[model samples]
Target: MLLSDFIREGRKALLALYPAPEAGNLMTRLFSARLGLPPHTPLVHPETEIPPASLDLLQDDLDRLLHGEPLQYVLGAATFCGRDFKVSPAVLIPRPETELLVERALAAIDGAGPGCRVLDLCTGSGCIAWTLMLERPGLCVTAVDLSGEALAEARSQFPDRPAPHFVRADVLTQPRIDGGPFHLIVSNPPYVLERQKAQMRRNVLDYEPEMALFVPDGNPLLFYRAIAGMALTQLLPGGTGIVEINDALGPDTADIFIQAGFSDVSLLPDLSGRDRFIQFQRPF
Candidate 1:
């Protein structure tokens, strides 16, 4: 079958779940990433035939997409902080907004002493951890996650780079993780309230790891409170901690760190201008 015909049908099939533009983009990404064809392949070579083997693979991926599996999980990777990181059902797919946490983290660590340390809590796919270690050389990073499967997925990313020491531990349990006194502590931990799940798409609800994406609605700040408690002892004096937060609880999330004895607690916004992150510092 011709690539153009495949793209037309794929976009139509995906329209049930995604808008036309997004569906088209997904199709473009699928062809480019999976088949190594250019994004404009359908436009430039409309008659290009998809081989039987490649067509079968595309059909399998399409089936998964139609069934509410995220494209990232189907593709087995997600891009975060300008790097593609391995992802699976065991981990949450990285989001673009989480890049803001990494940006702020890099800023906080600027001009730090050699071998600066970072702690990443609930490090699902290790996107933030790997991005920091790669974007800034000579840094020591330790990442923690509860699920062995999630830890395995995080550990498998970027083997050639200086690896963060991935630990299997619950973020809610404050005393377990060591190798801290870190210059920076960052997390994109589970902040989505259970009630908010209704507002989300089926692809995320069904495919992403539930442990990595949600908290009980009655205790919406569960992970933030735990993160704040852990940061109190783990972060060094004057060190920074940042996290991606649910937009609906921006001020409340910031107050968690402030009430935990952290200083300079700040609620920040994402590109959409919704409060999406909180940053705080350990007093010197």
Candidate 2:
């Protein structure tokens, strides 16, 4: 089948789930990944034919997308900080907003000296952990996650030896890191309240791991509380902590750090002006 024909049909099928522009974009990315052609290739080379073997693969992936699987999971990878990281049903796909957390953390780290210790709580897909480590080469990062499948995927994000150290630990339980004082702590932990699920789409609820996404409706800030409490002793004096937070609970989430006695507790907004991150520093 011609690439143009496949994209036309794929976008039509996806239109029922996503908007026209988004559906078109998804089809473009799908074609790019599956065929190694640029998104605009089909527009230019409308008659380009796809071989029978490739068509079978595309059909399988298209069916999965139609059934509510996220494109990242279907593609088996996600790009974060310009690096493509492996992803699966085992982990949550990295979102563009989470990049804000990384940016803030990196900015905070600029003043800190080399060889600083970093801890990443609820490190699904290791996107934040690996980004920090790669962006700041000398920082030692220890990342923890409760899901073994997620830990496995996180470990696979980069080179084994030079990569962030991945650990299996429940963030709710205050898992101990042998290294006492981390210079920075970062996370993009579960913040979605069960009640908020209604506002979300079926693709996220069905494809992503529930444990990595949702919290009890009664306590939407559960992970934030846990990470803040853990930071009390684990963060080095003058160390910084940053986390991705639900826009709806920005002030409440900042209160966790404030009440915990961290200095400079503040809520940062994303591009849309939603309160998306909480940043604080351990007292000097």
Candidate 3:
């Protein structure tokens, strides 16, 4: 079949299951991947014949999409900050807004001296950790995730980089792993409330790991609180803490950081201008 025909059909099928922009984006990406084309390349011309195996692969992906699987899981990877990272049902797919957390961390560490230690708690695909290491080669980064499967994926994704000391530890646990006195701590931990589950799309609530998304109904800020407390104890006296927060919970997140004794607490907006990050410094 021609590539355009496949994309049109795929778009139609996905639109039934998702919003137009999401469906269109997923279709375009899947089609590009099948044709061995860069993601931004124009869709293949209608007269161009697609290889049989490619057609079969595209069909399988479309079936997965129709069943509400996240496109990132289907693709087996996601792009974050211009780098590709392996993704799976074991890890929450990295979102573009989460890049704000990385930017804040980068800005905080820009003038810091060499040998600074950084910690990325709940570091799903290691997106934030890897980005930090890439941007600031002088910083030593350790990434922690509770799911062994997610850590395994992160380890495989960055084999060349000094193996990020991956720890299979929960963020809410006491006595964090002994890699700090970290100079900076960053997290995009699970912040979605249980009550908000119904509002999420089927692809996210069904395919993405629940442990990486939903918090207990009454304690939506549980992970934030846990990370903040850990940062207070583990970060250097003048270190920084940067976290990606749900836009709706921005005010509450800022309040939590302040209560945890972080100074210079501030909330920053994402590309969409929604409150997306909380950045603060530990008191000296």
Q: Pick the candidate with the highest lDDT.
A: 2
Tens-digit lDDT track of model 1 for 1-284: 98888889999999998999999988888888888888988788888899888888999998988887888888998888778899989988898988888999999999887689999998889989889889888899999988999998889898787799999887786564778788899998888888889898888887788888888989989888888888888899999999999899988888889889999998999998999988899999
261-281 per-residue lDDT for model 3 (tens digits): 889999988887899888899
Give each model's clash number: 0, 0, 0
Among all windows of 10 consecutive residues in model 1, the one with the lowest summed lDDT is: 171-180
All candidates: CA RMSD (Å): 1.2, 1.3, 1.8
Name the weakest run of 10 consecutive residues (lDDT summed) in model 3.
38-47
| TM-score quality measure for candidate 3 | 0.94
| lDDT (Cα) of model 2 | 0.89
Q: What lDDT would each prediction earn against the true structure?
A: 0.88, 0.89, 0.85
Q: Which regions in candidate 1 have their CA more than 4 angstroms from the true location?
A: none
Q: Give the per-residue Cα lDDT of candidate 1 at 29.
A: 89
Q: Give me the runs in candidate 2 sitting further than 4 Å from their true place.
A: none
Candidate 2: tens digits of C-alpha lDDT, residues 43-81: 788889988889999999899889878899999999998
Clashing pairs in 1: none
